[model samples]
Target: MIKREWAGETAVIIAGGPSLTVEDAVYCQGRARAVVVNDGYRIAPFADLLYAGDAAWWDGHQGAPSFAGQKWTQSKVAALRWSLRHIQSQHAYGISDSPERIHSGQNSGFQALNLTYLLGARRILLLGFDMQPTGGSRHWFGNHPPELHRDSNYAAWRGWFDIAAKQLVCRGVEVVNCSRETALTVFPRSTIQACL
Candidate 1:
């Protein structure tokens, strides 16, 4: 586990929101980089890092991106957990080849957000983490099929995001629900200009 230091106050966090300001973009670079979440990995060029259950980290045969990179560590009370050992076999094909960086042991959304919080960041922005699919707004799973699962598509995206947002706020790590389209109303929600 890459346990981040609590006292150092490092990095920021961005969801896959489309409206990230240039200032936030700059914050993701240089020394103390940022850690983006989920599809945040694909659209985003930088995030000090990312986290997910072992299954989400990749596809079994090809090692391309998959829903595993965006899943909760453990299935919710309503959902069921599936085997992701296939990802392990494709280890050589991912961004971080190390075994430790991929497996999600048993973290739900709370656990995943906590990984970023442990960094002791001064600021963490939950960008357009709007979990809703908004009719046709697609997700990664829709573009890439899960090799061993069923119905892991765009709609489930909302449930995972809601859990993660709630987890972040419950832990007192400021989370903003900036997506005008997704009215989850989980947190108070806010908007702030990135410091210029």
Candidate 2:
């Protein structure tokens, strides 16, 4: 079973952005309790992720040959078509975000973020989760970086993250928008260091 040490510690969901590095992983190594993998798209290259959720966000692309051989341990929260296979097994969490008018068939950090939100974290820092796909999709995961592609779900995810941030702030949960590119529209909350 995947040990959720970060259950009570500060947890950050590592998105598929081109900014992740050994330094960041090393920094979050002991500091973070668990990690949430939003999607596996080219994420397997990194492999060392320590998240409890490996939810797949790409829907239509499920048939893509690239996904056939990917592997994830019990720490995965398979979504979409994969969810169809695991839905009866209890891994499927169903449609996370209600409606934001975005092509979510391949976007959303709900499972990971929601997991962190409910994990009793003192504070949450959204790292490289600039869901807008502005920059690249997770760097330092491997020696070769992926050719960055701006997907249609960027703005939608950005809006969704903003909404969640605001909701968490209202519920007394400290939400920090550390995503370098997209700034959240939620109410201001204390930073990670402040919460500590």
> If scored against the real structure, what TM-score would every candidate get?
0.50, 0.53
* Model 1 TM-score, all chains together: 0.50
- Root-mean-square deviation of every model: 9.6, 8.1
Task: Report the C-alpha lDDT of model 1 over 102-178, residue by residue, as the tens digit.
Answer: 32312222234445554455345454444545445434224334543334243444444555555555555565543
Predictions in order: lDDT: 0.42, 0.42
Shift of residue 15 alpha carbon in model 2, Å: 1.4
In candidate 2, what residue range of length 10 has the lowest lDDT sum?
A: 96-105
Instruction: Name model 1 segments beyond 4 Å from true.
Output: 6-12, 16-33, 60-111, 140-142, 148-172, 192-196
Tell me how far the alpha carbon of residue 89 in candidate 1 is from the true structure, in angstroms, after superposition.
20
* lDDT for position 78 in model 1: 14
Give the alpha carbon lDDT tens digit for every residue of 1-196 in model 2. Answer: 2233344456655554545443443344455543535343344323233222323223333423354322222222443435322111122223222221111223334555554454455566655554443454333342221332333455555555555565666666666655445434453533333333
Clashing pairs in 2: 6-33, 16-137, 16-138, 17-137, 17-138, 18-138, 18-139, 35-51, 54-77
What local lDDT does model 2 show for residue 113?
Answer: 59
Best by TM-score: 2
The true-versus-predicted C-alpha distance at residue 99 of model 2, in Å, is 20
> Ten consecutive residues with minimal summed lDDT in candidate 1?
85-94
